[model samples]
Target: MPLPHLLRRRAPRSGARRTARRLAVTVPLVSLAGVLALTGCANRERDAAPGAGTSTTASSAAQTAAFPVQVTVPGTDHAVTVERRPERIVSLAPSSTESLFAIGAGEQVVAVDNQSNYPEQAPRTDLSGYTPNIEAITGYNPDLVIASNDTEQLVASLEKVKVPVLLLPSPHNLDELYAEVTALGKATGHLTEAEDLVRTMRSDIDKIVKDTPKPAKQLTYYHELDPQLYSATSRTFIGQIYGLFGLVNVADAAGGTGDYPQLSPEHVINANPDLVFLADTKCCGQDAAAVAARPGWQSVTAVRDNGVVALNDDIASRWGPRVVDLVRTVSDAVTRTAQQG
Candidate 1:
């Protein structure tokens, strides 16, 4: 689920010139949110209680809403059938684990991959670690398995063993994110709830679109992946946030690497972004402004104006329920900067 793995580095420590620009960096825990949890035998409630209720029909609606389906994920040969609502579930990705928890199915999740720490409860649950331990997962006796792009092999074996697996294709942008959330919600028999969340999320996005203070000029921004000045591609999710606010990513015009591409200070100096967004606060000793203050950055427009904005690493990145906050934060940054401009 680590769809984005930009190298982690230190950010610039210097503030930049005044400009209306915004950058969004989701939490560092996001990747753990991506490919996090795993499972084991000891913690399975089904095993603890003999003959646990296998009532596929927890209710008439649940039974009807849940059933078998063949879902084809990206980079896979064929669609696979998911037998039911997955009374016992295993999450092989941190994002999938976070997604399940967001939809209220955390209890149904018997295990998760390693690194899924945000929902600390997930780690506390039985875990098979980063990789799949078929025996351990089998011991927990999960009805369904959720696998990220990297874990397709595990999914294959689970399929051979007759265990249903949900192949979760990694999302590239916000639209795909909406689709994944809706898909997972439906798969989990929480379609209505998921749809409702989508509606609310869209509403938040719409407000950002509408209420965004019209700037007289398109402000330029740079999203630092780490302490390093490496920038995100224009096609990336975080890059799209700047676009949504009608701001410019200097890298966009320069043609970003379409991924987090580390660049020389000379590159940033030439791009001359008006705003600098750091991926984190100083809490962990990672500072964005300091990066801008490095020897060659002194002349950049952003460095002169104090336009460096530190963001919450998690909320800024995730496309889940917290996306509302992403839009809000972006909109606020845009509006705040626009007013000052």
Candidate 2:
């Protein structure tokens, strides 16, 4: 699902660098695996999936070790331990929810935040990741809760009730994203499946980057978060994906302090990016035509050459398995632009 209308354009709550790193952007389909050797993101030694010829004793030991897994929360020194495989999991972060379902832990999810609308089968509830209600959450009797933030002292509150919470924040890069997947897998006892998913994702993304045609003249782009011209810079996570294709982000030169910067229409027109990626299709009803109709935007190079791309809000907003799809979409657009040139 698209971010809540009010939050669709809000910057991150942290410092400038982190703030700039979190803006939603167009996702690519057919995703990446640049480094497969990262056993687990939290520094835990991962045992390989038992071979078919492995002894039963070894397999049993592997299964035993899968539990009592400990994962360091992303961007923090503190770690949370999953004492046992979580049977009743409640996910408050949409990205984490998607990761759980993708890693084969769907059946273990007892409930998910309302924003976790993908997978369709996720037990969608009225629970809010933002401003969570302690009573409503504890009522579900969840063994584990995964959220993006500790909003309203949620972690402390849950701890008071003896419920374990895993804080998986928005990743700063692909490596961090993979680590989150690894962490979730370990926490849920699906480490092997998670490793497999990471390998596939890495392989797919690497292929997409290598196969896409690189334009002779490097293409420049503008990633629109909304009609108001809020944009993501090259320093952001989505920006790194664009960097894979050698696309330049005009927002970087717009003199904004963070990853998600609100650019003046004048700066965009002056930069006149070769491509305009709209991430507000679902939230704000924007499209190529709407962009062309904007005051002075018709003169933008992207508009004149039909280079405006409308991205799926949900896919663009979440960094998960579907990132491969987002990558594919960008690849197709880059191919078209190169062909036109």
For all candidates in order, the CA lDDT equals 0.56, 0.72
**Candidate 1: deviation at residue 98, Å?**
2.5
lDDT of candidate 2 at residue 178, scale 0 to 100: 83
* Candidate 2 segments exceeding 4 Å error: 1-65
- What digit string (tens of lDDT, one per residue) describes model 2 on residues 181-212? 88888888777768878887888889988999
lDDT for position 258 in model 1: 35
Error at 138, model 2, angstroms = 0.8
Tens digits of lDDT, candidate 1, 1-341: 22231111134333221000112112211211111211211123234344333432243267346576555544445455766767788776555666677655677788775534446677434453334677777877878777654342776677777887776654556666667666666666655545655675667678767988976778888776555454566566666666777777665555543355556677778888777776645323445457665888888776776667776554454445555555666676677778887
Q: Which 10 residues in a row give candidate 2 its minimum summed lDDT? A: 24-33
Top-scoring candidate (lDDT): 2
